[model samples]
Target chain A: MQPVAPSLRRKPTVMSLLARFAWLPLCFVLVGCHIDMYDQPKYRPNRPSDFFEDGRSMRPPVENTVAMGSFEADSALFTGRLNGELAVDLPMELTADLLERGQTRYEAFCAPCHGLAGDGNGVIAYRGPLQVPTLHNDRLRTVAIGYYFDVITNGINRMYSYAHRIPPEDRWAVAAYVRALQLSQNVDADTLTAEERALLGGP
Target chain B: MSAQIFSRNANAILLVSIAAIVLLIVGIISALIGLYLSPWYTGVGDAIEQPVPFSHKHHVDQLMIDCRYCHSTVERVAHAGIPSTDTCMSCHSQIWTNSPLLQPVRDSYQTGEPVLWNRVYDLPDFVYFNHSVHVAKGIGCASCHGRIDQQHLTAKAQPLYMGWCLGCHRAPEEHIRPRDEVFNMAYEPQMMPIADRLALVQEYQIPVDGRLTHCYTCHR
Candidate 1:
């Protein structure tokens, strides 16, 4: 073999060694670039769709169509009316559990405008500077139980329909709670026993 | 020794180069870890811009509306449903009827077009999280979302890292609360005793057989 000069032998200097591993850092940096699995090419719930004209990933049910097993056979459960007039009685048997459910539902959906006491003193009513009708009034107190359900299902006056927020059964629950509230506020003092009066903290 | 081919500084350069390489590797790794955890990368506190600048503080805290009133399906389904325009109008039709801030909502209502909301807690597609199951098992809204009732604009509270999730899944008793308090934003996990939480884990039938930590639990 011909003798080669040390200069031409290509000594592995610090710069050469550094250059050898320079591509290593690039590997780490590039790892973050491929996030295909992170965000897949499929539509998630409410994800905007470019293909749809409205850009909604969730398509609305066809007009005048109801989902399977969702349709209520009892018209009164849905409309809060029977034979075209407001049903005076609850469609389902009223139980303590139902009343409790009603109380919670009312506090959540109705109490925001229809005060906790149903006197229309809810926080929203106060802030709305709008006259939300008191549920304790003569007409409201005398109205059929289904009347409250009807009003909630199809809003009266300034009230928008809460059908979207509160389901039909929940609307009935709120109605039942409204009745309970009316009864609570309208108790005749003379009818109470001394023990009951003592419990009520009233003379 | 006769030729003196190498310079004295060569050893110094070699030592410094070795130290520099070690430091470079350490520095790069540290930078990557730091960026991964940062709010900029993780979007932990980023408040996404919505067409309507709805203040959760105003609606949830000040107004005292229930979280379920708006996110209606949180207890019933996987997705904590965004309220429809009508849910907004249920109050807006009576209140804030003319605010310029609610113009997009009004337009959406009138046009029958959905208001495009920017998602805040966008988890990766591979992971399957069910809001109903967690809610039923006694995880509060604030557990993962933080004190959202206090946030003027909703922002991400958790980084939603797999390790953060496994931290709880591996031992859920550390975070579980009463089923009733699941909606209470102020309720803390520590408020309930460890014994009670363990009891709830049993009562709620939360699997403690390492099934929660299994690969298919979330990924599938």
Candidate 2:
């Protein structure tokens, strides 16, 4: 095609070009305003779901299905029982580190109700207007180590199950620490070394 | 004949119109940028109301409870697990059994429904953040959560802008603390000497080879 004269052909003036595309900024504004990417339809942790019956995005495990590597139902470590009776000792070796770990876990999970010294004087017990049993009592002091694990796992009258919070190994650790706490409060002065007796004062 | 058709003031009026248009564009852009950065848009410090008005200050600062007491899976998982209704009733069943403030919690426990807490510090869906990696790498909870233990009502402490993330990824040594001190809200990052901080970065095996800043590091 032959080219037309410059003036004869239509030319886009700046104003006309701008008028043609005036909605460009509006598009940018609208696109920027949408938060679809920030809040996608996909579920993240704890997001509520309308599709599920319980409205929870997460689902509970199937009934009676044991998880992998957790099938040891008969072991004293898992059941806190030896044959028909509660085991009187830990299934694993006790170390200072284990005691320290037990102390930390105890302070976090148990001390709130049982008292740090197992004297039933925790802040929750005091404010709870409830009488928590003292671990120093003769019955609890003489109870088998597995009894503590069972109590922690199954919970007693007013106490709820802590199985979800403290795992089996930690339960054993706490049992050992509870035994230590009993010994601490029930120790005889004659059993103490000269240095330890002095530390207790009243020479 | 056409030369004198327009008035003499038209030139000045045209110039004024151009300047006004330029100023308008600049003003609009600036206003939008300002809005984007504002607390209203970023949701920084705005405490979203929850079904129950749970106070971190009371539970953490007053009670001295460990962070792991509730957020038990923070050390092992990508998401810090929220406490179940049973976790609440663990203590509430003993104390505060009659308080109206805990009614939702009690109701949830009885009804087997989950308490719906308003989401705080929700990063964009595109971002993949792992709580375990951060904790394992010695990033303190306060480093990102900003003294959440002190906030009576949970709120967004950081704007969670990509650049803000990059600021830490670029120089992690400045923010890294001892692994034991990760949950200590009062821990000061500067308390540890620079050499020790650098040593910790090395000890934790945090990649200083620009991998932390890669696009896939967060976006994926």
Candidate 3:
């Protein structure tokens, strides 16, 4: 190893130690604020609130305030009601395409609780106390299509409302499909088309 | 001073100290890198310890039960909701009535207390994922969850990072299926004759442009 030059070999003086350690205090003061983006002042889901009277973070929508494009000009179509009673007929026209769309939506949404055949033996109903009522039954079969729409829009007994998930058009479609399922199961053989009748061995 | 600083045995000591410091820094960096890439941190293919061992393979593959049967809120809720104890007892009540494995489920049914299932595909708090939107958009469960029907114990099939999400958001056609076959696990895509597949994408009303690729689509 090379020997240090006489000039470089300085004595360890108190002043030198102070000069060498001058950056220590500056280091303490220079730690800039590191606010983690995730840990910032924010409200999480279902967090309680001091601002609301109810103390819930989720606030109820202002009463009677209509959302843009969601204004229900036709009360019958949105609510299935005409003068505080369930309407007899659907506000919208029923078509083959509408029935098909209804079938798809119904299968996805309703088939879990209401069986694919409307027998109320859906995969979920088989579980425990969550008994789903059958659409093919007399009480449901005689009810207006609008009644089904109403019940779907605003749930009944143990069944939660599906209003948010099922659009109005789809809700009407589902009601139509439920009617179709009811008819298909309860239909007389004489009412079938000749080809359909023959297919069912009813010729 | 004691024989002057850096004078006797100073060079050897200085070299050793410098080497030790370098080793320590390297060790720390490597450890961090290793930890970040490890399965413990990334949770890739790691089957979490759930309260009860529910096999998707048995229900989905063997019995051929639809996914929506148990995940009742997949098409409506933000998260694909877990099955209630009642849903399990629906089948297990008749079949596995007395099995020791299903004791917790039976107990949960007897008592209203929920089964605290540990989530496997956990994302950071920042990622706001909506299941209904994706399912409605015709994105199949397999797209993100991988072949869940084959998994005995459910695991995080993908990294589920922002980059992984963007890969599909950038081009969803490859993953898009006919809406009819969305629940069909056996269905596979054939984009080889590219025109037909591209047409199918349009037919399904799939949003393919910058609409889903935006950061706000998922983050906010």
Q: Pick the candidate with the highest DockQ.
A: 1
Query: Across residues B25-105, which tens digit of lDDT does each residue of candidate 2 receive?
Result: 999999999999999999999999998888999888888778888887788789988999998888898788899999999
Each predicted model: what fraction of the native A–B Cα contacts (within 8 Å) does it retain? 0.70, 0.70, 0.07
Error of 3 at A176 (Å): 0.9
Alpha-carbon runs more than 4 Å astray in model 2: A1-34, A186-203, B1-33
**Could you list the iRMS of every candidate?**
3.5, 5.7, 7.2
Candidates by DockQ, descending order: 1, 2, 3
CA lDDT, candidate 2, residue A63: 87
Can you tell me which runs of candidate 1 are displaced by over 4 Å? A1-33, A73-75, A189-200, B1-24
Per-model DockQ: 0.48, 0.42, 0.11
What candidate 3 gets wrong by more than 4 Å, as runs, is: A1-35, A44-74, A124-134, A137-139, A153-169, A188-203, B1-38, B47-133, B148-155, B190-195, B202-220
- Between prediction 2 and prediction 3, the one with superior TM-score is 2
Candidate 2 lDDT over residue span A1-203, tens digit each:
34568989788899999999999999888877878998899988899999999999887788887778754777889889989699988999999988887887788788887899999888788776889889998888888899999999899998999887788898899999988888989999999999999998867
Question: Every prediction's TM-score for the first chain?
Answer: 0.79, 0.82, 0.66
**RMSD in order of candidates:** 4.6, 5.1, 7.9
Clashing pairs in 1: none
Instruction: Give the docking tier of candidate 1.
Output: acceptable
Decreasing lDDT order of the candidates: 2, 1, 3
**Positional deviation of residue B167's Cα in model 1 after best superposition, in angstroms:** 1.6
